[model samples]
Target: MSPKNYEIIEHSRGWNGYFKLDVYRLRHDTFEGGKSAILDREVLERGHAVAVLPYDPVRDEVVLIEQFRPGAISVQKTYPDMPLWLNEIVAGIIEDGEKPQDVAHRETLEESGCTIIGDLEYISRYYVTPGCSSETVTLYYGRVDSTNIGGIHGVVDEGEDIRVYKVSAEECFAMLQNGQLCNATATIAVQWLMLNRDRIRKETSALRP
Candidate 1:
């Protein structure tokens, strides 16, 4: 038998615009087989997104981009010397009717001018901020050619001013170790690559004729 564990008391809109904020009043079953008291929670509705770290196994390098994040303004006040511009992996929200893999390829070229070379290696799928935001991200490690992956690239209408560049895998990992990388997706992807780089390099090398 299955238990109906949750009940929604009320669902309402807190704010709706470029992004949505919703309010939920609900109650759910507790661990001791009891119903929890009614709770009020505000959730930011960001939906789904995709992020990809571009790696050039042949050159032992990675493609990264720096862009100014409007949300970082408040963060810089609390964190000492926090730069307004953050280095991050290529990412974008998944549009309606669009596939995650398609968004990975599209954003990679639009943001970094780097085209993926092979199938993307799936890394993880996670909620970015489970406590407050309804945003989940699908992450990947994409193979690319880093030979010409340097310049400023982004859609002009989107107000993006991105500076793209390539760095040796060693340098990228060192940035991770030194607390220089702050973007969540970048942080996760880099840590994952650190563990899997050896196998990834071997596989890529095997493909070389």
Candidate 2:
């Protein structure tokens, strides 16, 4: 249903930073065929982002990066053993007038030093948190050669301290299974590759350089 279906009683704005928050007061249709009472909701207005998983089908290897995330520390505060640094796929925000594919390629190079070998195979586009966030992420699987794709790489000005890892696809799957790949994007990417590895290998074998 269109958002027009809701009666916008009021709209307000909140924090503005890397993301903005908006407050909405509205009411919508009900299953009983009557409009409900006004309800207020606060939503984090995070812009869309793109994440790409680099895989070398022939070598059976994958490129991943590890970086510290302060958000994780804030959320999982009770667990003292919780790892603040997370292993994740290459990802970046879509800059003004930039496409998802462009960000994917740029992030892959900056984070892991692996250039995307061919056209990206789209995996999924999804909301990271719909309950109170407007952030949506687009995912892709990019073919890459995993040879010598390990080191520290990232934009110094961005304060990004990234460590790249080139691991066998089987080992990556194991990480996913063992909770090492706890981030949402990495988990989803690894799961999709696990199910489609053979077909992907066959389809991209000839495309390898």
Candidate 3:
């Protein structure tokens, strides 16, 4: 699929902030024929990140986080009922030379004060918004002990004020069906958990730590 059938007619920098936006005047291979017209498109270089859903199979619970997302507020006019503070799985951006697994564990502890132990199960790697943003999330499922897992945790310097909580796996599935887990990352992770919960619970190695 990596064919040299596309041309970058021209590209210019648009924004050089937290997210770098670039305007591209390019043509790419078309499904029906040769190439598309040199149409202009703006792409945001948001970089890649990692996510992890920490589960306590013994307790049948999953750790979750709540935070205010300015991006959601920015789109409030279009979706007037959109919420500002959203509940989601723990996640963070991957720095240069950092592995996705490492970032997953790091974010879990940073956001929820829970350390992921035992075998880490990989869930998925996907683009959050491929149409306009170059952001992708590598998702995982990690084992944890939720005996005393509850807090509001996050790096103060990062301006991240995160509230952490745990819920029964059954309740999480219900939330998924009712659109409570609205974010793509949380939705995907919970849906996967719904299908694989039994197997995960049966894994003695996964219920420890």
Candidate 4:
């Protein structure tokens, strides 16, 4: 791909604690010709996060977390008669000096109260939103025991109140089909599980002779 001509003029933290504004000067290279442009862009530098889809091949279940999001409150007011909370995979931002896999493992424990055993399979990495934000996320798949999970778990200091659920793979798939699962990260993680369910089940079932 050809490189686009763009220069960052200035960047600084915005009034909001979550984002920064970036001023840029650009020379657009359209198919027909080139055009000079100057524009300001807001970039969210929340940094990278990790999302883990914990699946139990033995029981054919998937672990999910349900939580109330302040971001969803505005949309809930639009309906005025429905709940705005969401069900999503265990996710957390990468802490300083923390690896992505470590973040996934730590979040799974803190959010779901389940230990992730065995290797973590990488799914994909992509920008959550590129239009005006710079948040990138890494997705992964791993195995967890559903039998030992119970009760709600979350970091109180961060004001997170999360409920953990262990639902069958079939049920999770149904939720995805019926539009119940709406978040992009959860959708991608669940779909990845569905695509690899059979193979993962078979491989995980067979042990070394």
Best by the lDDT measure: 1
Quantify all predictions' global Cα lDDT against the true fold. Answer: 0.93, 0.91, 0.89, 0.85
Question: Candidates' TM-scores?
Answer: 0.96, 0.94, 0.93, 0.90
The order of the candidates by lDDT, greatest first, is 1, 2, 3, 4
Q: Write the per-residue lDDT of candidate 3 for residues 38-156, one digit (tens) a residue.
A: 88999999889999999988889999999999989778989877788998999999999998988988898999999987768989889888999889999999988888988889999
lDDT per residue (tens digit) for residues 98-170 in model 1: 9999999999999999999979989999999999999999999999999977989999999989999999999
lDDT for each residue of candidate 4 in 1-209, tens digit (9 for 90 to 100): 55465555565666455544554444455555564466666666777899999899888999998999877888777866545778899999998899999999999999999899799999999998898767888999989989877678999998889999888999999999987887999999999988999999899789525
Prediction 1 global C-alpha lDDT: 0.93
User: Which wins on lDDT, candidate 1 or candidate 2?
Assistant: 1
Off by over 4 Å in 1: 1-4
Better of 1 and 3 by TM-score: 1
Clashing pairs in 3: none
Cα lDDT tens digits, model 2, 11-96, are 98988887899999989977667788899999999889999999999899999999999888776778766689999989998888
Better of 1 and 4 by lDDT: 1
Candidate RMSDs in order: 1.7, 1.9, 2.1, 2.2
Q: Find the candidate with the highest TM-score and give its number.
A: 1
User: In candidate 4, where is summed lDDT lowest over 10 consecutive residues?
Assistant: 18-27
